[model samples]
Target: MMGKTWIAAAICAAAIFSVFPESRAQQAPASPSVDAPELAALGSYGIGVADLEFIDKGRADPLQGADVPRVADRHISVKLWYPAAAKGGGTRYRTGLPGETGSDVPFEVPGLATPGAAMAKGRFPLVILAHGYSNTPEVLSWLGENLASKGYVVLAPAFRDPPITIRTPAARAGPLTSRPLDIAFVAAEAQRRAKAGEGLLAAADGARTALIGYSMGGYGVLTAAGAPLDPGLGGATRGVLAPFVAGGPKADTLKVADVKAVVAISPASNLYGTPLWAAPGVAAIRAPTLFIVGSQDHVVGYETGVRRLFDQEVHAPRYLLTFREAAHSIALIGAPPAMRESFWDFDWFEDAVWRKDRLMAVQAHFITAFLDRNVKGEAAKSSYLDGLVPNSNDGKWPNAPTGRYAGFSPGAPASTIWKGFQPSRVSGMNFEFRPGEP
Candidate 1:
C-alpha cells in the first residue's frame, strides 16, 4: 500500500513537470551566438541620477470632490537621468508594488547610474518618460539610464496613480485627468529649469524634447504631444477633466511646446468603450511618432487599442513595431525577485512568450534610432528607422558565407534584414512606417 501511494505521487509530479518544464526559469535559455542589437548597447557617456520634487500650485485635484473647500496643489516627484563623467559606482533603487491589503510590496533594482555624479559637458536633448499607471520610475531605469548614456537628459515622473484593482469610475477619473496633466507640468518645469541653467538640468536642451510613455503613460504622452481629448472624458471624470478638453479654457496646457518626437508603448487608447483620441484629435499631433505594442496584448488590447490609435494618427509620420505573440509587459523590465513569486505580479513586467530583456533591448534599439533621427535631426539615423522588410521573417541574408557570423544587417539591396540588427536576433517581429500627409 505504501509503495502504491509513493508511486502515485511520483506520477503526479512527473505530469506537472512535463506540462511546465521551464516554469522555474520562467524564460527560454539565452541564445549562445546571437549578439546584442547595435543601438541597444550602451552609448559613450556615463550616467548620473537625481531625484526632484515639484509642486503645481493652485491645481485642481480630480480625486477630491467639489465639496472640498480649497483647490489642492499637485505635487510631482521626478527621477532625473543625465549624461555624466564616468564614475566608478552605481545605485540600487528601492521601490514598491501594489499589495493585496492596499499597501506596497517593496523591491530593489540595480542601476548603472552613479547618484549625484558630476554632469557631463554639453547640452543634450530632453526626453520625458511617463510610466504606466501605478508604476515607478525605478522599474524603467533600464530606459532612463540607457538614454542618459546615449546623450539625452531623461526625466521620469512618478504619477502617484491608483492601483489597477480599483474599478470605480472615480478611481479611473484621477488617472484619466492626472496622467497627461502631470506630463505637461513636468515638461514645462524641466524646460524652465533648463532655460534658467538650474542644477542637474543645466545642460538640458529645452528646444529639442521627446516624450516616451508606456501604457497609461502612453496615453499621457500622446495627449501631451497635442492629441486632443474626447469631450466625453468630462462627464466620465465627473466634470473635472472638462477644462482640459479640446477648446476648453485649459486645452493648451495639455500640450508640451515644441515637442520634437513622441513614443507610445502599449498605450491605452480605447478606454470607456470608445477611442481616447478621435481622428481629428490624433491628426493634431504634428511631431513624428513611434508606436510599439505586442500583437497579442490583452490588457489595453492590440487591434482595437494601440493599433487603432496608430492608424488614426494620419497627420504624423509614424512607425509601429509589433512583437509577435508578446503582450503588455513589453514596456517594463523583468520582474524583480519579490515579484517573481506569483504569476499576477510577474506578469506586470514579463510577457509569457517573450523575455523581458529581449523586448527591452529591441525597444531601446529603435527608440534610440527614432529619437536621434527626429529630435537631434540626424538624417543618417533615418536608415535605422526606415526601409526595412515589414515582416522580420521575410528578411533575407542569402549571400552570407557559411563560416563567419553575420554582424549587423547591411540593409537595402545588399540584404533585406533590418539595419543594425544581427541576423539570428531579428525574427518574431514586424515593423511598418507611414509618411505623414502633405
Candidate 2:
C-alpha cells in the first residue's frame, strides 16, 4: 500500500472537487497568500525555536523488526517555539510535507522563525501540539507559531509512525500504544527542562499549560488529560491491533495532571468499531475544552467521532465549533509549495467547504480567546466565549448594508454581531457550548 500521505492526498483530492466544487470555488478568497493569515495577526513577539530529544526507558521499541536485535528504549524528538527578543538575525529551519516519488517536491520546508534567537523577557504559558498520523510538526506550525507570538510557548512533537510501503496494521500497533504516553511524557519533560532553564525551554512559564491536537493527536491529548480507558483495552491477545486498545499494562501511565485546557480538532475518538473513549470514560476529563470539527469530516465520522467525544465530556466546561460542511483538515497549517504539485496534495491542506486561510484565521481568533480565558486567567476574554451565536451569518441585521454584518464590531449591537468576531468577516460556522455539571 502507498504511504498514508499519498493515499490521503489522492483520495481526498478526488473527493473534494467532485463532492463540493461549488462550495469550495465560491468560498475561495480573491488572493490567499502562502503565509498563514492568523500567524501574523497576533502579539508583538518574534519567534525562536529549538529541537530537544528525550529517551523513554519504560517503553519497549515497538518498531524493532523480528530479524534485528531488540531495542530497549524509545527516543522522542520535539520542536519548541517560543517568544523571542528581536535583536538577533533569524535563522531558517526545515520541514517535511507529502510528496510523490522521484518528484522535485522538497523534503525540507524553510522556517519562518529564527533558530537560537535570544529568548524574550518574561516566562509565558506553554502549549503542546501533537499532529495527525504520519504527519510532522511542520504540518501544525501555523498554530504553534501563532500561539508563541501570543505570549505562549509551544512545543510540537513528531510521533512515531510507519514509513511508506509499510502500512500494515502491525506498524500502527506501536504508535497507538505510545501516542498518549508520548504526550504525557513530553508535558512533564517540557516543564522540567524549562524550570531548569534548559535551551529554548527557558522561555516557558510552566505554571499554565494547554494541549492542542489534531486527528490522532486529538486522541492522545484526550487520553493524557484524564479520559478513562477500558481496563480490558490494549490487551495482548489482539495481536497487531492489541496495542491500541485501552487499559493494558501501560494504561496507568498515560495520564498527566494539571492541564489547564484542551483543544481537539477532528479528534479520532472512534477509529475502531468501539469508541476509544466511552461516555463514562470521557466524563473523567476535568480540563475545560474546546472541540473543533467539520460537520462533513469523512476521515473521522462527525457524528460518531468528535461530536460523540464532545457530548461525553460532561465533567468539563466545553465548547463545540462546527464548520458547516468542512472536512477533517479544518485547522492544518497552510499548504506548502511542495503540495501544489498535484490537486490531491493541495487537498491535504484545503477544506472542501471553507478556504484554508479563512478557516485558519477563525481558528486563531477563538483559540487565542480560549487560551487567554482558561490558561492566562484573562477574565475579559470571557466576553468572546459567552453568549455565542449559533450561526455566524445569523447575527446580521435584516437591512444591514451588503457587506455590513454584526458580532464583532464595536458599533454593532450584541444581538447583531457574534460577540467576539468582527462584522463582515464571519460566516458559515456554528458554535455551541455546554457548561460543566457542578
Candidate 3:
C-alpha cells in the first residue's frame, strides 16, 4: 500500500544493515539492492531459461466439436518463457514484481539492472499459465518468471487480452468457445517447437503438461480440460458490452484425463454444481489438483469453494494451500491488488501478516513443487506438498506464507494455521502461513 516513494524509505531503513561485502554479521558479499530471481541451483530438472514466443493461432473448430482452434494462421500470439541455454543474450525487461513497479512514479533502481530470462538447451517440461479475465498474459509474468527461474518452460498467452468490440450478442456468444481454442493453440505450438527443434520445451516428455490459472483463468484450465464453464459463472461478462474474456468447453470436453495436474489459484467457481460446470462431471476431473487460496480471499471462497466443486467427487491427486494472512491478490503474481475497487483503504494490505513477497513465496513454492512432482515425475510425498515438512525460509521471505510462517519450523505447532480466534475450518479459511522447508 505504501507507494513507490517508500522504496526510498525501505532502502533507507534497510540500509542500517550495511551495504558492503565482508561481515556486517554473516560476512557476505555486498548487500543485493533487491532480491534477484534464484536461478543457480535448479531443482532436479535441468537449468537455463529464456523468453520464447510461439504462434498460438491454432484454427477455431468452426464445427461443434469440443476441440478448439483459433482464427489466425499467425494471428494469436502466445508468449512462452521456458528453461533455455542460459547463454543466449535475451532482451531484458523491467521488474515484473507487483507494487515494486512504483505507481505512476519514475523509476529509481538506477542502472539498467536486469533479472535473468530463462532458456533451456534441449526439450523441457512445459507449464502453461493462464491469467484471469480482462487480464493480459503480462499480468501473469511473475509466475512465468518464477517457474522459468526454476527451469520449466512456462507459456502465458493473451487469450483474453484482445480489445472488446461488441456488435451483437451472438457475436459475443461466438468467441466464448475461443478460450479453450486459445489453450489448445498454446499446447499445439509448444509441440510444434519441439518438432522444429526449439529445445526441451518443444520436446516435452509425453504429455508432460501442467496448467496454473487464476480467477476466470482458474475456470479456464478446468473448462479447457473439459469441465464445461456455463454462463454467468465464468465471470467473462462482468457487466454490459465488456470485451468478452475468452474461456471453456461446453460440458464433458477434455476430462481429468487431459492435463497431468492443475493448480487453481483463487478460481471463482461460485456456481460449480449448477448448470454451469455441473459438479459431477467437473469433479470427475482425474488429474492431481492443488486448490490454493489466500485466507482473506472471497474470490474462490477460499479453497473450500474449490473443494466443493470436487471434494468428495474427485478421485485423483489433490492438495490445498491457505496463505495465512494473504489477501485474494496473493494468488496473482505481478497483478495489481485483486480487488482494486474495494472502496476500503489500501492500508488493509499492509495490516495483514502476509506481506507481499511472503505471499508470493507461498504461491510459487506449492505450484512449482506440484508440477515438479506431477509433470517431471519428481518423487511425490515431497515434504513441501505433503506437509510432512514445515515451510522454512533463509530470512528472505519468498517462502513465507504469513509473516509468522516467515520463520516457522517443522516441529512448530499447527498454531500457525489458526490465526485470530483459532483456525476452525468451519469458522472460515485459515489465516496462517506454513513456510515449507527449502
Which number leads on TM-score?
Answer: 1
Candidate 2 lDDT, tens digit per residue, 107-211?
444445668878899889988898987778866766777777678999888886765422454555555655676898899888888789987777786768899
Tell me the tens digit of each residue's lDDT in model 3 across 190-273. 656656765545445325778788776776676655564554533433221021222433233333233787877777665333
TM-score of each: 0.90, 0.82, 0.61
Candidate 2: pairs in clash: 91-114, 95-109, 233-246, 234-245, 234-246, 406-417, 407-417, 407-418, 408-421
Model 2, position 257, has a per-residue lDDT of 53
Candidate 2 CA-lDDT value: 0.71
Better of 1 and 3 by lDDT: 1
Give each model's clash number: 0, 9, 34
List lDDT for all candidates, in order: 0.84, 0.71, 0.48
Residue pairs whose backbone atoms clash in candidate 1: none
Between 2 and 3, whose lDDT is larger?
A: 2
